[model samples]
Target: MSNPYFQFKQFTVWHDQCAMKVGTDGVLLGAWASVERARRILDIGTGTGLVALMLAQRSLPDAKIVALEIDEAAAGQARENVARSPWQERIEVVQADFKKYRSSDKFDVIVSNPPYFVDSLECPDRQRAAARHNDSLTYEELLEGVNRLLAADGLFTVVIPTDVVDRVKAIASMNKLYAIRQLNVITKPGGIPKRTLIAFSFSNRECVIEELLTELARHQYSEEYIALTREYYLNM
Candidate 1:
């Protein structure tokens, strides 16, 4: 079993009450996401407020960050976690289904490590099943929500299974969100990509495609990964 919480350099993410525990995917999205131009930020499906906290730690002190979650219990945990962090005043946790979530204000940057599995066996735990599967929040639904909340020049970013990269890119296109940057994540130098980190914007801008290797070998983290996450991970 995983631990009840994950300790980082600046904060702790308590996950005992959340369906999805802290993982590398969340860490990657949190560290890799660009908040340079973000004044207002939003995190969708923020299980334990990890990404929300990470962004706030790296962003300007005045940046407004919101963590949106559909699960009531998870949302409560997120709120508690954020309150314990240094960025409590900067990050807000909201319990609302992204599909029905409405905000009169638009966000400058939106990041998510959303449910990506479209075809997968359900976990015995219903809450985890909900957190892991895409049924509750389909790609189309996520894209629509992003399109609705994202400002014209704002960026919408996500990390998803590589198997569905093409399909997701197409859906983003349909939603009028163009792919602006992409990073294929692999386990090793020559390994096949397992996940794709993508960033989208409203304009038809030139897309920058790149590759990221997370590990040099089994149990050995790569330099690039260390550098990217050095500010957050305790041992990095």
Candidate 2:
């Protein structure tokens, strides 16, 4: 694959060396993560620095964004992408596993498009498999890390397969993190939901569920989807 497999309006991501390339899930989480008033943000498993760059573009100018990736190759590619962005100074890519990384400061918002293919069939490539599977970072570890790193009023957002939403919610609840908002992402009008975008917080509030259809049919993007993603998507 070429260096830049994906290009946005203001930035281009080089994912040739990354096991995970730029994808819609990362774009959704990047644009969907609430960063309007957030001054400090953290992105876990930032594959190609897509989410961090999106947050940098969406958030305030002075917002400080940190991204963590375990794979050295992916982290290097992320660093390159961050350096090319306009908000380079405000964003930093750390080559470390989220479970072992520590910080004195708590983040106002934490977002992730984590590895959730637990107990599923494994792929041939070890790095790609690790990035997609739970062998390197488990749900428990991710939840615990979020609990430790998130501020009291902070919110944690993630994009996961709909099948795992219940299990993820259970794990998050065990750590006292509650879902405040959720969006079910479907490909078409009657198609089964493929992903769930969940926003959680420390406070226990009534969950607001919103069903979002990305497209009315194949190759047709919905108005709502375009509206939500217009800022970062070049063709939207």
| Worst 10 contiguous positions by lDDT, candidate 2 | 1-10
Tell me each candidate's TM-score.
Answer: 0.97, 0.97
Candidate 2: segments with Cα more than 4 A from true spot? 1-3
- Per-model CA lDDT versus the true structure: 0.93, 0.91
Superposition error at 94 for model 1 (Å): 0.5
Q: Tens-digit lDDT track for model 1 on 5-96?
A: 89999999999998899998999999988899689999999999999999998887799998999898999999999989998889989998
Model 2, residue 77: C-alpha shift (Å): 0.5
Q: Give the clashing residue pairs of candidate 2, or none.
A: none
Per model, state how many residue pairs clash: 0, 0
